[model samples]
Target: MKKHQPAYLKSHSDGTLAKKLAAANARLQHCDLCPRRCLVNRQAGEKGFCGAGADLKISSYNAHFGEEPPISGTHGSGTIFFTGCNLRCVFCQNYPISQLGHGQPFTVRELADIMLELKKRKCHNLNLVTGAIYLPQILSALELAIKEGFDLPLVYNCSGYESLDALELLDGIVDIYLPDAKYNDPRMSKKYSQSADYPEINKLALKEMYRQVGDLILDEEGLAVRGLIIRHLVLPENIAGSEQVLEFIAKEISAQTFLSLMAQYHPAHLASNFPELSRRLTKPEYERVVDKLHELELDNGWCQEL
Candidate 1:
């Protein structure tokens, strides 16, 4: 009602951002920032499972229109694609940027400049993609951006495997959450993403995210201001456990939870090597998930027309 303002403004004014930035930066020493718990001190130049160091590596930043309609809006979501991912999903489409680390290093000041620049382009929100590996740097840059009048909403677009501690730092700093419920089955997650703990971590992460921002809130123009937007990319043969994901959202989280049922699966990266993930999601596989969504009374959100 009172004209939605970005959460960081309050966090910054209350001095919460400073504290969160400090605590997050400290995690680089041991580097348990993600679910990986790769205790290799990233500040000491030790590369962990994510292949990220202290320096922030970003692939690109742009006003993207490829997100959900509410997120993209009339302008676009200011997307900052961070290079390197904590998980190694075999079918990753952005394999070059996420796995092979195709990006250039950026200072916190330069990163802050990018945020201001996006705001100048009238982007709806600052969308941070694959940000788990660079939480500290993002926070530091956000602090700088806030000082320079970056008033846009912040979207944490991440693979669902997250650390609760890392998320705690983002309590009031982030406004919208665009996270994936990538896999529901532990075996499938382990086989594809090499993270046996993805399901458990993703579930817990979603809970925290939902607690922070309850349901998706749209403005007068149907643009998202704050809230969680769950993305479940439909995988070939249901390897992504789509039914279980929808069930969890409907029963555990909320039936009204904003969902973006994705049908854009293609055998990229090392997916060709794995028989289970070697093909695009079939019409049947995607339809089944959509049917289940209706069955579960998930009336809110968008279903891709594939």
Candidate 2:
């Protein structure tokens, strides 16, 4: 079997990647990168709702094996955890990195070097976590990496509250999109993540991602080459609206859509502030969502054991 060349390589060779990089950089002036539309001029050192500026701040990078099998493979995924996030989820597991912004800033060239280093370590793909805020910098780093023979598949690991414009810039550049379908209820979204428009925005983002990459495709070695993988964490008390999310994926997206039904929702961060979110996800709650997964015939991915 032929080794799968990532889509960004073609985009780079054909000049599409450069165009995207430039377009993404242009957004920094007004900064509508995510759904927040915080018109702050990040290039001029202003911080927005996500607390990110022009500088690229990264919490960590490593070969991670804890992701979905296709993404991690045997060598593990090259994971780059970016600091800060668009959504203020009260139960965010990585609050130190996402909320408190615990990370070191790096120049674009250094960021590119990190990608090269990850490839040298033989990771399956470059998995960028919470990167929507730093899209421009990531694109810049990717351009530099591509020139230096870095060809790992790019994974846009993100919260589903994405802007269509930002995703448009990434159309050809990102090979795999790993987005979370956090909630189907606006009330739940608002109460938990502090984003009232999350459900509506998330659905649109999922649809756009599906349109860009129809279904998950694995290589001969069973590693993902390209696709859209939607993850839904079964929150306690059905606050995540897991059943409705599954139905939408099966009906609106595709029955063939790959899913990661996450059953690891342990209350963290400020989850204790909300009585409904203070406990871990129960076995029954997770099993109910698993049953819905089977009932909807959306059986193309993994479900963790509760």
Q: Of the candidates shown, which would achieve the greatest lDDT relative to the real structure?
A: 2
Q: Candidate 2: global Cα-lDDT? A: 0.93
lDDT minimum window of 10 residues, candidate 1: 276-285
Q: List the residue pairs that clash in candidate 1.
A: none
lDDT of each: 0.92, 0.93
TM-score of each: 0.98, 0.98
lDDT of 1: 0.92
User: Which stretch of 10 consecutive residues in model 2 shows the poorest summed lDDT?
Assistant: 280-289
Q: Residues 118-216, candidate 2, lDDT per residue (tens digit)?
A: 999999999999999999999999999989999999999999899899889989888899999999999989988989999999999999998998799
| Residue 155, model 2: Cα distance from true site in angstroms | 0.7
